[model samples]
Target: MIKFTLVLFVLVSGALFLFGSSASAQNGTLFFSPATGSFAQDDSFWVNVMVNTQGEDVNAVAAYFTYPEDKLEAREINTANSAMTLFAEKKYGQGRVEISGGKPTPGFSGIQQIASVLFRVKSSSGAATLTFASDSAVLTDAGNANILNLVASGKGAYVLKAKSSASSSPTPRPSSSVSPTPTTSSQPAPSSFPTSQPQFSLSDVRVDTITGESARIAWVTSEGANSVVEYGPNKEYAFIVLRGELAMEHQITLENLSPQTEYHFRVKGTNAADKELQSEDQVFTTGALQTQQGKEEKGIFGGRGLFIGGIIGAILMLLMLVMVIARKRGESSLFSQE
Candidate 1:
């Protein structure tokens, strides 16, 4: 009986030791770039996913995460099958292998803590949200050291700032004074021109019936300035350089486009002072190859010139008829007098 009791005590001690090691071995962390969680389409961006292997030391890390396909575009990630690399190897003390989709959770919530994380995103407006939920993952063993989960999750969003000279806030100034005499005086108003920054806007846009090559663009401005355009086929602009030129007028014709292709585009307006204002971007596709150009054609007779001529001719004919009737009545009166 004494021998059996001693054996049981030894087994319990070994089990507790294993459990303690597993609990202390796991960790997780998340990192992103641009400081502001936003990115432009066709722009390159990244999400650095890391895991802390308590003290056991790890040779590899594997993780999984979900993402919102509508708002973000993902490139390569740092994992077994992605664009990222092993952020830190097993020898770097406790560090993470940058994975593509691993996300972080708020530290305090139980449900949020255990959730799997994923993704760095790019958007049209350079704005989007990255979210994580309550989920669990399995930690595989590298060799002797077993890993415990230190799962974490949190929220991140992306936003693109507009380039405008317009004031984001109201400007303050001292009040004007008037003389005590019975005379009135007027002061010239301050000018909105030569502002520290310029303002921009886009409007009156139309697509052509031909291939994506031609697009008609027009817009208004508070201050007159030149314009520029940036556009491409993809949501992200990694492989292509910006396409732009200098011009005036609220209208322009864009030509040489691909058929049935989707494009994203934005405009920048510059003032005389060389200040720039940015307009919100928009997307469009070239019409079918067989579609006719312009909404409708104008006929010559239906034009203003023909209509004006017809009005003049009708007035002249009415005057001639009235003069003929007056002459006939005057001649009949002279015949009766004779």
Candidate 2:
């Protein structure tokens, strides 16, 4: 009877392990769209990093990845039309790119495209693969923690074929070998230059108030971002202050300024993807200092008034002495005549 009961329990456990979708499955599955493809050298393509929340409400997502630098180069990240409005960080360089985005609770569910990366092929007749780093995460809104875990099973693989004859001449071997490295860089993307990077736009930047001793600045963003204010006596921006919280409205105050002086300033902040961006050069002149400097100016003018009053009194006393001397001389002359 004991052996039969043990056998029954084993069979039931096996059935649950094969069919269960809760604990036995990873709640979040991160993957790339168009997981496999083929392209020629210098051909540009885009790959999207997607996430499936698996019915769990996830608030944050981080997708940092690496590719073979020898075969591919990441060009840019575009989030213009994406669902995510808050981007914490976006970086691409040295054959690696990272993108982080999230929203406040109650979080997001279902399949979502976090961001898209554009790449240019460098090698001909070879393969390239893009894989996510181990530390990437999809944080849940609840406490069970990944509840289970996350997986990056949908890696992107591509084949780089030889360039077409017209676009790329094959006979010049030296140039072909050296051209791959600089070809993409030489392509002028004037229109997309500014937007190609992971940068945020700052609007309604206002100097709320500027006093001799302190100044306040306020600005707004399209989405949540960190706050940064840089100000100095010149464009060099000698002073910098920042607040690391994520919010749509931002304000920063700068203190200890010289009265009646011009200060050059600019504001910097991060997008939902954590890409740093700065505003144009701005100018603000401090009004008269309210406290110690005001007293000092009054003292300076007061000294000048006292000095002028002393000169006038000395001239009047000299004139009065002369008049008294002339009267005494006339009286002496009259006495002698009498």
Candidate 3:
């Protein structure tokens, strides 16, 4: 036993010494690039990956790194996901990379690069966190087999955000220059308009479901104006009179409109003195309103069915209670007689 133990100790010590020498040889050797910071959305960025071999000839070695999806988009020449690319920075000697496309290794390892990968992030609403990693495969210029010194870094990008507008008003008429006469059917609707130069803009433009001979008109605006709608089936001048309003937006139900017919309308902004300005024309088509009435009727019928079902359930519960009470009473009488 003593002789066997002595032999084992010598072999273990020699192995430990060789391992220490290999680790120390890779010291003072490192590789990196200059771009290490946050980037904007929809922009391109690059990084260089290298290794320090302590003045030793390195060959046939591979490296890899990975970034977050939201932070960056990458493409390599030999990668499966062609949309991603590995940028070739001039600082490193020109060596083309061949991407190996396959299932990512466990823990997202296969997504890493042997050297470097380039990224192009698109517009995003929030910040994206990114990570990078690398691997060292067999270095074989002269039969040296030692892969170590794996390093990683992380960064982020900021994306712009968008929001919907808050205004809710009808569109105002164009300046008097745009509309010469804003009269309706030889008569003007009762309304007050801005005495100053009419400023007009449009927002919340949408189409509503037209039914029967009516359609609801609604919009949002910053200023109140005397609103008049000029509409016709074909010719531009063929017009009709809508009500007048001084509110920001006007919701008017156009009455006596033809079903399934296309019509165009232009809103007029008028002053007390009969000066008029018109907005750009808007067009829409009317549809049959019968479908809307049928839906309402179905809703009412469903509510009535629920009410009838509740009444029936109450009657059945009452009947059950009466039957239970009669049985208990009969059992008590029989017990007393016995």
Candidate 4:
């Protein structure tokens, strides 16, 4: 009995030790300002990309912005006076906007503005959503290793209203050249502009596989674009996976999930012309705790601990049974002699 007790105690202690050593990684946040707003046809506005270290220093960042090409157009990108000293911007086939930048000497800490983008509302009335391309946005430290546990809130939507006829009249030209130039050039009335917006879609969104601590999501896009997934315990979608490359079919794997917990996720992508597409929110529950136990068995004992534990337990049981039988036989013999 004592030997069995000792063996059980050791097994329990080892299991606890393994679990105690598992620690979660630290994290930060990246978001965009003006998360929601409204714009009129022919109106132009700016949005700022911001980052919060949540108390960590970041040296580099790359962000991809996507919008509706038929309803909205990116006029320009401005990074002047931002934390990033060096930066580059590019526009691709549809409506994809890519911005990569970094600071060398002193990394950024706390909340800071990364860049500003100017967008113009086209002659259509509808909703337009701006999103960051999956896997395309990343934050890195001085060593160039990605900072883990990043919370990205780079999704925002705006409603476009039809331009009022009274507001479309041309402003009187200034009598003097001293008058300041208009910030926006005059445009023809909305009636002359295109009436329809460009269309983009994502299909075949499915959860490929889900384990205790990881999941894989796959989908196909109507057009080639960069892939990204925003997922979390709920719809807030605090975590993101940016697959910085462009493709027609996209797959992303999310790791370090909790066992048997529920998670919500959605897909976002941008084509060459900067047109962005988003999937509807979906839910999935991770596998049971048995999956985690399998991981521990593989990691702690390297596929041998289970066999060894079973052998030890069997030996202890056998010894207890032999001792009981021996005691009974000895007692019987003594009685017969008396």
Candidate 5:
């Protein structure tokens, strides 16, 4: 038992993003490039969050932004050519899009692209606001401290016109030269905009294989909508997971969890035209991580498989010592006590 405990102790080893202001600072800037725009209903547009570390060597970033579910539908998140080469998460739902990503050892500085979100105008002739959540952060590689200063970190407002008629000319999106805060005065919806909103519904909702540390939820909607999964250790779930881009089919992964815990989770999706669909609270006990020679076989570690090898080596050493002691005792018996 002592030996086993020692082996366990030896095997267990401890292992251990973006927010803030639109304007560049000593720490960094976490803001969308084109802060304001206008579009007709059903028209799609893209906006991206950019960062400038300003000579600060930072490694990881996380951004959380919210839009009006009634007016705009998030379709997808694009990371191609993004400075954050590794993404810890990409999620959107309930008019919220969250992205947490990072780079390798030396970290990154200067100007770079974080992520691009494609949004489709859904509601007719309404004002929409997409702004960064205060919880967003840009973490330093050294200490992982959040250095984003969000005091007046810009906000983006958009005007949604009714779908253009045959003779109407689409209003060109405004320039980015001015403060783009969301307000009714910034750009008002035309008087001809549609007034009816929708009550959305969903189908084919399912929860897939939930492992020790991650849970996957999937659902289908008649129309493209944002996806959000709320999960926690119990019924009062405070954690949120989102997949911002809107689509009829949605899949979301909830990770970083404790094993053997009973977690309560629910799914919420909002489609264009101010419609929402939700699932009843569900429960599931998490599972233990599957491993070959003990310890995680795959995951964030990405190690060289040294843990199992050390355990095996320790066991062999113990066995050899026990054999040697037994042999010496046999020899001390002096041929059956002759």
Candidate 6:
């Protein structure tokens, strides 16, 4: 009886351990669509926040996003066709925005669209980033249990270019009496002036160090020139990095990047003669979010295996106990007959 009781206790304890570990191991991801892009000054654009449950059913979500107030203005929040049945939003400070909402019943599974925010560009010519404040963000299951540990990645950015003055309608020139005499003949000699613009080249453009949240880019120019880097998640370069100084070598670091993401970038330089040069677009991808996720998965599977083994061992022990009782009863009956 004692042996049978001990076996049952072990089985129950192992099953409980396995269930707890598996519950905590589930993970998910939240990200933005049209992650990177460029816009002209005063141009309006929209970004959508998305969630991938990663096989986990999530019922509630809270996201906090921020941008450069001087460069962008949050215009509106759209929740049409979103997975969220009810939502509330708030805007604060220069460019901080917060959104919290959830589906009432059944929650959400697989990939879901949360909300979309519209923004208008304000900066004349510069780059700005839209970042998710992970510390303040939260994701929960149907029971309102915090599951933020499952969030793998969520960060993004945008760049704005000032409208060129040349593109605008030209102002009419004032007529003046100073337009006196026109010269009939005087072609300057070719030797008296430089014919072509200065020639230079950009080389060795590469991504130096990349992490889940940042990246560093470096390159060399044949001549000293002002350095600029335009990059984005796609071929359309939308973000710009300016050194604002002349140099033969240049390096720029981009921050607030998402993990397991691919980015496209190109180099630009302006020589002393004001001639501009651009390089071909290049690409780089950030590191994956596997370290923590891998450990969680392992723990869950290992716990399950242990639980199954414990159940099997408990059944075998019960069978042995029954066999021993049967043998003892038979021997006692035979002795009584003798």
The most accurate candidate by lDDT is 2
Single out the weakest 10-residue window by summed lDDT for candidate 6: 176-185
Candidate 5 lDDT over residue span 1-338, tens digit each: 66754443232211011223323343456766455567898899998777656557787777788999888899999999588776756788789998876776678865567888999999888788888887777776666656675553545667788875654433433443243555445555643253454336787767787899777888888788777677787776645555555798889876666887888888876665545677888887779867674555453255546766777899999999999999999998987798
Off by over 4 Å in 5: 1-26, 167-338
- Minimum summed lDDT over a 10-residue window in model 2 is located at 12-21
Measured by TM-score, the strongest candidate is 6
Clashing pairs in 2: 86-272, 87-272, 87-273, 88-272, 88-273, 88-274, 89-273, 89-274
Q: TM-score for each prediction?
A: 0.26, 0.41, 0.32, 0.41, 0.43, 0.43
Clashes of 4: 16
Candidate 6's error at 285, in angstroms? 28
Per model, how many backbone clashes are there? 27, 8, 22, 16, 19, 0
Query: Which candidate do you rate higher for TM-score, 3 or 4?
Result: 4
Model 1 segments beyond 4 Å from truth?
1-36, 54-56, 78-122, 125-127, 131-156, 160-338
Candidate lDDT (C-alpha), each = 0.41, 0.72, 0.45, 0.69, 0.70, 0.68
Give the alpha carbon lDDT tens digit for every residue of 1-338 in model 1: 56754554353333334432554334433212111243445545555333333223233233334345655545443334222222221111111221212212211211111112233333454445443322222232333222434243323345633443244323321222333232233222224343655444435443333354567656655666554455567644211111123344555454555777777766555554445665676788886554443323344444768878888999999999999999999999999999
TM value for model 2: 0.41
Worst 10 residues of 5 by lDDT: 9-18
Worst 10 residues of 1 by lDDT: 106-115
Return the TM-score for candidate 6, rounded to 2 decimals. Answer: 0.43
lDDT digits (tens) for residues 1-338 of candidate 2 = 56754554353333324332334346576766555567999899998777766667876666778899999989999976454666656789898887766666787765567888999998887789888877566666564244324343456667788887874555676668877767667666664786766445678988998887678988988678777676788987755554546678988877667799898888776654545566898999989856777678777775888878888999999999999999999999999999
lDDT of 3 at 93: 16
Error of 4 at 219 (Å): 39
